[model samples]
Target: MMTKLRKIILIPALTIVSLSGFFSCGVDRWPEYAHQTALDTWILDIMQQNYLWYQELPSYDDVNLFVEPASFLSKVKSKQDSYSFVDSVMATPLPTYGFDYSLVRNPDIDTAYNALITYVIPGSPAAQAGLERGDWIMKVDTSYISKKYETYLLQGTKAVELTLGEWKEVEIEDEEDGNEGGDGEDEGPTMEYRVVPIDEPVEMPAARIVEDNPVHKYEIIESPVKNIKVGYLMYNSFTAGTKAEPEKYNNELRSVSQKFKEAGVQAVILDLRYNEGGSMDCVQLLGTILTSADRLGEPMAYLEYNDKNTDKDATILFGTDREINLDLHSLIAITSGTTMGAPEMLIRSLFLEDVYPIATVGSSTKGQNVATEQFINEEFLWSVNPVVCTVYNSQHDTYGAISPATDLKVSETTIDGSTNYSEFLPFGTFDKDGKSERLLKIAIGVLDGTYPPKDDKTPEESATQTHFKVEKSVSSPASRRFSSKGLRL
Candidate 1:
């Protein structure tokens, strides 16, 4: 849906500089106007008028506005709200290891844990050191993984030594199996895998700013079925572009869709397993690319603001990017719990008028059907991106969590008969040896009508399944932060 930036609500400048003028005298130069109270007052004023849950806001008298803006906003915010937040406009971006990791307790060693590399950005130090998604980190510096070292993986910008390891399955014959001659069981006990450390430690350089392109990878895949070409796009974020080139990434998306159309792609798969969400402008652009021309001018989705700001409520309509629009009946969205905010809105919008359906695969989404507008006080170097409205598809439906049409939460079996979780493969490739990276494979299956395998669990049964356990997960700062970017309009 093409939705333009409708308005910019400029709060009266109540920043430190403005207050500084009010406290001009030497005797009482730092008066009430220059205190945290004024800043908090400014924040409250905006939230009360624009926040989606304005009615649930705490009374002004009950909040301790003397506290820092972050803490003060937290105190006054509605308990139901999790996406609203205040950020320092002058804050520097956090340097990162460029790889996400999840910690899992080592069943073989009591209280010991291992870090599983979740995903590594290309050209990052982790990739330079030859780390892949399935790799493991057994120790951090000299400390083995324990409660004390559980959070070491998240120490952004810190130089650290990582002891690499591998997950291996060792067959342990059951003492009661009695294969020698007694009543031997038909099969051995379930196989188990253990993490074994490598001999040398990897010297991980200090975290640095790694340039990540939201348009990670795109390709035209030739399906096994004759006369069918599938477009696979692994999109990690919804960012439009940098300040210098606002439409840079959006232009790239247009190029990819044009390529797909030229290649006669019959189906498209959007892999958003790691996307946490970003600008709604990009969402509208991508939605337009996937929708059919006949669907153009239809309501893709709409934002519902609080009563005080009902005038801001707007519907995003599907528009044509004539050169690239695919006009497909349906498309696939590969999602995980990390997919949220604008990405969720994009997924819901695909169901526009029920004329086009989105076949979502993988795990449940993060369920953030809300959009935020950033209010910046540039003079004071502060900004607040508060959730201004709840988003809904044309059908007026908002999901608690967007469950996948197919779920791939089942565990893999090791050679020793124990269960081990499968790891993500590099984008676009399927594991012929095993079922790892099943999300993309299943999506491809849907296009070929071979999905669900006729033997696999139904979507309903799979929805109740739980992912394999990990002690803790650590994604890049952007992946963990909500409303990191805002929908401009």
Candidate 2:
């Protein structure tokens, strides 16, 4: 790789005078490795050109660039940056079982545990195998799962067969039924109810490279408010399709807008509770859809880069007449700790517009007010994602961990020997029993104020939120990347 090129210093006097070897002119004539691996050099060159905190980076000559590319990147990155990292070029979407899980101990056995499914990627192997967000894996292959073997759960490039289990309410005859052996004060046939696992084995195929459709689900829902409808969208990621077809997912978002327009929805429910983030273009485009038509062509958001890349700093505008724009009054975002980056940016952009109130339903979002650009070197088979710029709304306003109008902590788990089946419900407009998830129910309640099923207790009292207590996690690397890819441009 070093044989590929050369570096010409424009200012020889400066290089000779200053032993520091600082590129005062900041200009490189050609490809230069300078005793460093081509990968590491490329990483540094890209970071110098785009990193938002490039001024804080150590000089190229001062840093050890001969180390591994990932290590070199770590050494050079600014101390404030935590989202920037290096990975294989396949980080766009890696092969996987397509599900993330938490390891919980088995109540019956101290050593044994189960992998509780947290979220499954749509159209992935886990979803195809009839696995869901609330399912459990009691055993992997023939061995019962325990914390010791948790690292091997759904990992590597091999096929895995899992034994499934679910919590069910079962009746058991009580031994102490108030009967004193023929004294006979029997309280009928005493039975104790307990929620225990009904184990069933399931065969899961090997991992495969699966493309995720960030637009998980979209539909027009009849609102609890009389004669009004709401546009509901469950967006998982902000991905703009693959490198070859960048417009694929963006086009799908436009189609969603068209449907919402046709439905004449008065309010919108944007479900981004699981969305981690994606490209800036998708964020701007979706912002256009949610914003009132009058706000079109105005500044949606802008990027602030380091001093060296000020020329690259640009403001993203709302879509024009060519793009789909909704005339809705307000939007309710379903967000959680998983929601970050572009999704949060979109919410703030709309809120700053003041066209209408933008209310959030779930918990606060993951604070990521910065954007990253992926630098993929096909020859080196490496991709470097460095924080390139800070993102702000049109008003130059930005925040961390966007708070919700109605704060609710929601999660899923299966605790055997307990009676809690509420978390086992599916995520959709409505479950099999035609019931909305807690988040959705609360979002609707925020809009119409007729939620919580009109129970005797107040809406606040009736609305109970619970979270999963995860002792360990068996989350796949692919799942982590999907949710951790912050705002991208």
Candidate 3:
């Protein structure tokens, strides 16, 4: 009986294996193998086609005909020592520099435009003329408000008159009453006030950075909305210092989160606008901390092949093992075109797991959801270009889903450097004529619990009951019941 049972099980297992093998074999051929062979053949063909005089000479081993030892020796002796040459080049001192902090512009508001301030250094001549921020910059010297004038004004060195609002050229001098009031006690410096709108723009100092200087720098900006604080940490790139590790990234994020919690911050906005992606390990560590326990072991994404080639083609990927229990009070992760690689993964993970609803206000994402491993030929040091290790979000369902969750599109009309949040809200993609202001109003109404939800009755239920015809825009994408928005219930 046992022998029969074993035979029965083994026969079915073998049959299934055979079927799987047959099915897999029927799939298309591996593209990488074909690609590599084609590339090699093309290279050889090109080399043969463009045979130079150098190739006409005998091989290196054919010393009898090709070798010129005397000439080669002479050439070597004529050149400087390689070690000495390299050392001399490396020994040169680097230039010293510093950054000017006089002028400040809101990065979100002024995308690429660097609006200059005409404020000179404290000891500089521009400061002597007096220039400050918020002064309505009319013109530099002789240039008017035109584009050419703006450019010319920027080029000018002389002082420019800035019209100050209301309080200008006002100074209050203290008068001492020496006989009765100031006779008993020594009166210190009295209160003095001065309001002067200097005509010239300030010539700010040049910006620079020291080679290996160690200086702690940080910025604290209070959020316009109540109970929200934004802390922006800008690092040039992740591969900066030698000792920088995964813990460094984790510690920084944890410290910021702790501070936010202490400050009673309702929401934390992690501004990674300038952060070019670094170590994947570091990104994983961060994700672990930001994510919750329920989502710890869950598959963040799968990395599989498009073709049914081999078992090695499949890979099940997951976020780091580290898990944080703390509530991730809404994460406002700011991203731009520059954000790529691991940064993109970080943003995607945040959205996928519902850790924090992402609101990408600026621009679209740089869609590079693939990781690769490089192999170099040891003898020639010629690298076989990156072998794709894993394709991200390979589940096929969420491959091209890197768009923003809120759908709050940002443009020039919505953004300004002023504190008017209302202005920002009342302007989005809803108004094609630039006058409708419908989307913003709708958003505001929704937020205020005033926008009524659309009634979506089923066909079967409607058929049973008395139905009335409803006039709706048929052209709108949102009209379909099972639309992309999934808002219709």
Each candidate's clash count: 7, 0, 10
Which stretches in model 3 have alpha-carbon errors above 4 Å? 1-250, 264-266, 302-326, 353-356, 372-387, 394-398, 405-407, 412-489
RMSD of each: 7.2, 8.0, 25.3
Cα deviation in Å at residue 143, candidate 1? 3.8
Q: Is candidate 1 or candidate 2 better by TM-score?
A: 1
Q: CA lDDT, every prediction?
A: 0.71, 0.70, 0.34
Colliding pairs, model 1 = 5-489, 190-417, 190-418, 191-416, 191-417, 191-418, 192-418
What digit string (tens of lDDT, one per residue) describes model 3 on residues 22-100?
A: 3455784444234333322332332222212113323323322111222222222213211100000111222111111
Where is model 1 more than 4 Å wrong at Cα? 1-34, 152-161, 173-191, 198-201, 225-227, 352-354, 396-399, 405-418, 431-436, 455-468, 478-489
lDDT of 2 by residue, 149-228 (tens): 76666564577777887754344456654555675564464333222455466777788877667787787877656647
Candidate with top lDDT is 1
> Alpha carbon lDDT of residue 47, candidate 2?
87
Please say which candidate is ahead in TM-score: 1 or 3: 1
> Which number leads on TM-score?
1
- Model 2, which residues run further than 4 Å from truth? 1-38, 91-93, 156-160, 170-195, 225-227, 406-421, 429-434, 451-468, 474-489
RMSD of 1: 7.2
Candidate 1 has a TM-score of 0.81
